[model samples]
Target chain A: MPTAKKSYSTGAFWFVAPAMIVLLVVGIIPLLFALWTSFQQFILPKVHFKGAFAGIWPIFDAPFVWLSNYRDLLFDESFRDALGRSFLFLIINLPIQVILGLIIALLLHRPGHEWLKNVTRIALVIPMATTFAVVGLIGRLLFNGDFGINNYFWNLFFGHKMEWLADPNLAFVSISIMDCWQWTPFCALVLFSSLTMVPIEIEEAAKLETDRWWHILRKVQLPFLLPGITAILILRTADILKMFDVVFIMTRGGPGAATELISIYIQRIGFRSFEQGMASAQAIVLLIITIILSRLYIRFIYREV
Target chain B: MIRLIRRLALSATCLALTAGIAGAWTLEEAAKPYKGTQISVIFLDRPGYRAIMKMLPDFEKRTGIKVNYEIVPYESTLEKEVRDFSSNGDLTVALVDLVWIGTFADSDYIVSIDDLKKQFPNIFDPNYELSDFFPLLLNAFGTWNGTVYGPPFDNYSGLLFYNKKMLKDAGFDKPPDTWDDLLKVFAPKLTQNGKFAYALQSRRGETQSCDSFMRFIWPWGGSLLDAKFKSNLLSQQSQEGLNFRQQLIKYMPPGIVDFDHIEAVNALAQGQVAMITEWSAFYSTLADPKSSKIVDDLGVAPEPKGPAGRKPALGGFSLAVAKQANDNQKAASWLFIQWATSKDTAKEYVENGGVSGRQSTYKDPELVKKYPFIEPMVESWQQGVPEFRPRFAEWPQLSEIVAEVGTNMMIGSTSIKQGSEEIGKRVEDVLSKAGYYDGKKKLAQ
Candidate 1:
C-alpha cells in the first residue's frame, strides 16, 4: 500500500512539473521583474535593476506629481464626458449581448438541432477570431465622416450627412456600436455553452407545466444562467478597460482627445514621451483601479457559489 | 560474421569522421573568404532602403563585404532594434532615425565611429567634405554633449510642398515666400470645394509637439526651454505662433486635430489640400504616378520665413554602429556606412529615388537635370535649423509638455496664452521632479 501511494505521488509530480516550469519562466519571473522595475529609473539593456537600488522613492514621489496627471484627467471636462460616454456604452451594450446570447443558446438546445447549433455557434464566434487592427480599420472605413456607409445612409434617409466619428458626441457611440457588433457573439457563445449544461428533466418539467415561454425563461432558465452571465460581464469589463488597439488604430485618442482612455494616456507618456518612471507609476495606478473594479464586479454579481 | 560486421562499422565511422573534417574546413574557408564576410544591415522601409538595395551589389563587388539587408516598417524597426540592443548581441549595422539617437546614446546601444577615421583614412577621406553636408544634417541629432554619436544616413529637410497646377490656377507663379503671403494668397487658392487650403499635421501627440509646432514656433521666434531649464513655451512669441496656428486651423481640414503625417500626406495627394508642409521624402511620393494625382504638377519650395527667416526644421535618418557589437562587426559596419554614403555611391543612390545628404550628390549634373527639386531641397537643408532635441535625461518628460499643451491648443480647449502658460507650469513641475530645477540653478523668469 505504501509503495502504491509513493508511485501515485511520483506520477502527480511528473504531470505538474512541466506546467510549473512554464509558469515560472513566462509569468512569475516577468511579474517580479516588472514590479522591481516600477520603483527604479531603469532603462533597457544599460541600467537594469541590478545596478541600482532606488527603494520606494518612485512610489512616494510618483503620487506627488501624478496627482497632477490624475487632476488633468479628472478635471478635464473631456475625460468626464468620455467616462459618461463609456457608462452609456456599457448600459446599452452589455445586457443586449448577454440576453441575445442566452436566446440563441436556448433556441439551439432544442432536440435534433445539431446542424443549426454548430452553424450558429461557428458564425457567432467568427468576430472573436479577427485581429483588433483589422477590425478597427474596417470600422473606420464604415464609419468615416464623409465617405462612410453610415453617413451615406444618413444622407439617403434625412437629406443630410452625419459625421459619425468626427463629432465628439457620436465618436464614443460609434466605437461602442463597433465593439458590440464584434463582441456580442462571444457573450452569446459563453451563455450557450453554459445553457447546454442545464438538466433536461428540469427544463422539460417546467415546459410541460407552463404554456408561456417567457415564464419558463424568467423563473427557471435565467437563475441557472446567472453564473455564466456574471462570468461574461467580469471578463468583458476587464478587456474593455485595456481596450487599446481598436481605439488606437481607429482614432488614436483623438478628434480632440475625445476617445482618450486611461490606457492610451499611459502609453503616450511611456512610449512617445519616454518617461519610463512616470509611465510605470501611472501604470501601477491603472492596475489598482482595474483590480478594485474587478473586485466590485465579482462581489456584486458572483455572490453565491 | 562478427568480424565482417565490425570492419564495416569501422569503415562507416572513418567516412563520417572524414566528412566532418571537410565540413569544418569549408565553414572556415567561407568565414575568411576574400569575397568578404556577409554582414546583416537592417533599415526601415524608406526610399533610402531602396537606394541602398540598388547600390549594395556594387558595394559587395568593390569592398568584397556581402551585404544582407532587411527592410522592416518603422514600428517594427524600432522594436527589433531595441530588442537586439537589449539582448547584447553583435549586430553589424542599423540605419537609425535621428530622433532615436539620444535614447540609443544614453543606453550606449550604438558605438562611436571615431577610431575608423585612423584605420580607414581613405574611406573617411576628409575631402569627401562631411562639412559641406548641411551642418544641421550632420550634427542635428544623436550627439551626447560633444561626442559624435552617429553618421547621417538618409537625409531630408522639411519643405513646403504645393500643387503647382492649383497654385498656377490661383494666379501664383511661385511658392509663398513669407507667412503673410502664404495666408493671403496660398490659403484662398488651397481652399475650394469644401476642401482645406492647407494640410499640416496637428494631431495631438508627437507630430503636434515636434514637426507642426516647431515649424511655426521657431519661425515666430519661440523656444521650448529657457537657459535655466524652465519652460518658456508661454513666451509672447510662442503664444503668437500658436495663435497663428489656431487661425490656420480654420482653413485646414475639419478634423485637423486628428491629422498625423500620413493623413496630411494623403490629403494632399488626394487633392484635398493645395499646400502641405512635409518632409522632402514626400517628393518621391509626389512624383509616383500611382500615389499622387499631382505627380508632375507638384512644386517644392523651402519652408516659408515668418518673423524669423526660413528656419526649416531638419528631419532625416542616420546610421549608428551598435556599441555591443564586436570589433570585427564595428570595422565592417563602418566600412559599409562609409561606402554607402560616399559621393559616387550617394549619387548613384540619388539617381534612383534617394535624397542623399552629400552636396556633391545634389550637384551631380545628371541628378540635377533629372530631379529639379534636389537643388531647392539642398537650399532648404542649408537654411534649416535642426531642432536641438534637449539631450537631458528628462527629455521624454519635457516632450509630454509639448504634446499635451500643444494638443490642447489645437483643439481650442485652451487659448495659446493659457496653453503656453500651462506648458510652462507643467514643464517646471517636470523639471523640479527630475531634480533639474534644484535650488542652485536660478529659475527663468
Candidate 2:
C-alpha cells in the first residue's frame, strides 16, 4: 500500500524464480498437459490429431473428444468398484493404524524409560522404512495357503485355514493388514514426537489431582494429544486413500476385483490398456474426488483444533 | 510288448543323453562387418534367459558384437516394452510378446524382417533357414497377417509336466491323453493327503489368458472370435469347455484362482502339486538343480486333448529389430538375431538351457535325452493356437477383459454363462469402437 515496488528483477525474485520454474516444469506443466490430454482421443502411434490451438504452440495438438471420456468414466462399473474398494481399504486400515500407533506412542512416551523409549521406537520404524514391493512380497509369502507361516500358525490355533488371496473378502483383509502393518509405524512415530512435547509437569499435576488413570487420561492427556491425533488422522487418511503398491504386488487387485484400489485401476487403464484419453479423464476425476474427500476429512478433524 | 519296447527305447535314451553337439555355430566370417558393435535387448527373467546370459561370452566371442542385455521381471517387462515402443525409444533390438506382433507390425514399431530381406540382401547368415523353425511357433510368435515381423526367440507351447513317481504310486504308468482321463483316471488317485493332483494358472492377468483359459477354450471346440470377428464366447462349444474347467477345478489347490505361472510352477517344483499344464519355456526351471526337487522324476506330455483336438497354449517372445535403430545398429542386430536363433546354434542353445524354436533342436538325440520335455513340447508347438490370446493391437485390452471374466469364474463368483456373455459383449464393444466389425464385411478374416 505504501508503494507498488517493481521487484521483478530483484535478487530475491531471481533466486526464487529457479525453484518456481522447476516446479512449473515438473508438476504444473504435466498437470496442465494431463488436463489437455484428458479431452483428446490420443492413443499414441495410431490415433491423433493436431489440436485446433496446438499448431502454433505444439501443446494443444490432440483431437478434442469433448468430455465423452469423462461421461464414460461416470458409468464405468470397474472404476466405481475400484473407488469403493479403495475406501474400504482406508476404512479398515486407517483406524487400526492410528489406534495402534496411539497405543504404541503412549507406551513409549515414558520420560526415563530408555529401553521402551529408544529400542521400541527403532523397531516401530522398520516397517515404515521397508519398500511396499518387499512388504507385499513378504505379506504374500506369510499368507500363502500352503507352507505359509500364517496358515501354519492359524491351523494350529483355529483348526482351519484361510485362503488369504483366493477369496475376495480374505484378500481385501489380507491387503489391508499388509498396508496397516507398513504404515502404523509412520503414524506412531509422528504421534510419538508430538506426545513427547506434552509437558510432563502438567501430566503430573493432573495425575495427582485425579487418582484415577481414566480420569487423568480423559481430563488432561486427551486434550494434550488432540493435535497429534488430528495430524495422524489427516496424514494417514491421505496416504491410505491412495495406497497402491501393497495391493498391486500382493493380489494385483484380483480374485475378482477384491483389492482393486483407485491407483491400480488407473494403471490398468493407462499402462495395460493404453487408453490414454480415457485414463487421463479417469485420473482427473479421481484427483478431484480425492482432493474433496481429503479436504472434508481435514475440515471435520481440524474443527476444534 | 509295449512295455518291453518302451524299456528298449528308454535304454537308447539313456545312451543318447551322454553325448553333446560339437559344431553348433559358424559366425565369424559373416559377422566381420558388425565386429565390436554394441546393441541392447530387454528380456524376461526366465531360466531360459539366464541360460542366454551364460552363453553370451561365447556369442560375443563368435559374433564380435558386444551384447548389452537387461533382464526384467515378466509382469513389468510388458509395460517396459510398451512404454519403449510407444515413446519410440532408442532400442536396438527389442523383445516382443507374441500378442504384440499385430500391433508392432501395424504400427511399424518393429522392422518386418521378411519384408526387409528384399531391401537388405545378404543380411542373414548365408545358410540361415527359416524352415528350421516349427511352422506354428514361427507363425504364432513372429509373423502377423502373413508378414514376418520378428524371428521367434524363447518360444513356448503349453505342455503337461507331471511327477512320474507320484503318478506311478497312484498306479498310472503314463500321463493322461484326454481331459476325461486326467480327471477320471489320474487326479482322483493323486489328489490326497494335503496334495493337489494338478494346478491351473487362473490368476487374473496374462497367465490366465495366455496359459490357462485360452488353452482350454479351443481344445473343447470353443473360439474367442468366430469367422465374423464377433466374440463366440457364449457358443455351445465354449460352455462345454468352461463347464469342464469348473468340474476340474475340484482337484486343484484351494487357491488356484491366485496362481500364476510362477506360483503354479513353484507348487509343482516343491511337489505340493503333482502336475502342471504349463509353458514349455519353464522346463529349465523344473529341471534346474536349485529350483526343482522332482528334477529326476518329471514327465512331459502334450496338454490333454479335448473334444475338438489337442491345441496347446502357445506363447512366446520374438527379437524384433527396432526400426528406430540406425542402419549400422539394425544390421548388427540382425547378425545377433540370426546367430541366436539359427538352426546350427539351436542345439547349443538348448544345451545351455535356452528354449529353441527350431524343430531340429527338439529332434536332436542328445538334447531330447537331456531334457525330457523336448519331444512333447515340439508336438504341442506344431498345433499351437495362433489366436490363443489374439494377436492384434487391440488385443491387450481384449485379453484383459477375457482374463477378468475368466478369473471371476475361477473364483466361482460368476457362472460360465454369465462370464462368457460378459466377455462376448465387452469384446464386441471394444472391436466395434476400434472400427472393426462393420455390418457387412465382418472383418473376421
Error of 2 at A187 (Å): 0.9
* lDDT, residue B288, candidate 1: 84
Off by over 4 Å in 1: A1-8, A43-120, A158-169, A211-213, A273-296, A303-305, B1-42, B57-95, B118-128, B142-144, B388-393, B439-445
**Per-chain TM-score of candidate 1, chain B:** 0.84
Task: Kindly report the fnat of each predicted structure, to 2 decimals.
Answer: 0.28, 0.57
Give candidate 2 misplaced runs (Cα > 4 Å): A1-9, A45-62, A212-227, A303-305, B1-36, B62-64, B439-445
Query: What is the two-chain DockQ of model 2?
Result: 0.42
Best by TM-score: 2
Worst 10 residues of 2 chain B by lDDT: B17-26
Worst 10 residues of 1 chain B by lDDT: B25-34
For residues B1-445, what per-residue lDDT tens digits would candidate 2 score against the true structure? 9999999999888766643211322477656777888888897677667777887898898878898888788777767766666655657887888887877777677888865676556566656788877888788888877777777888787899999989898998999999889988888989999898999988888877767788778999999898878888888998888888888898999988889888899989999888999988788888887999999998889999999989888888888888877777888888788878887777777777788887666656877787888789877876767778777778888777877778888888999899898889988988888778666322522
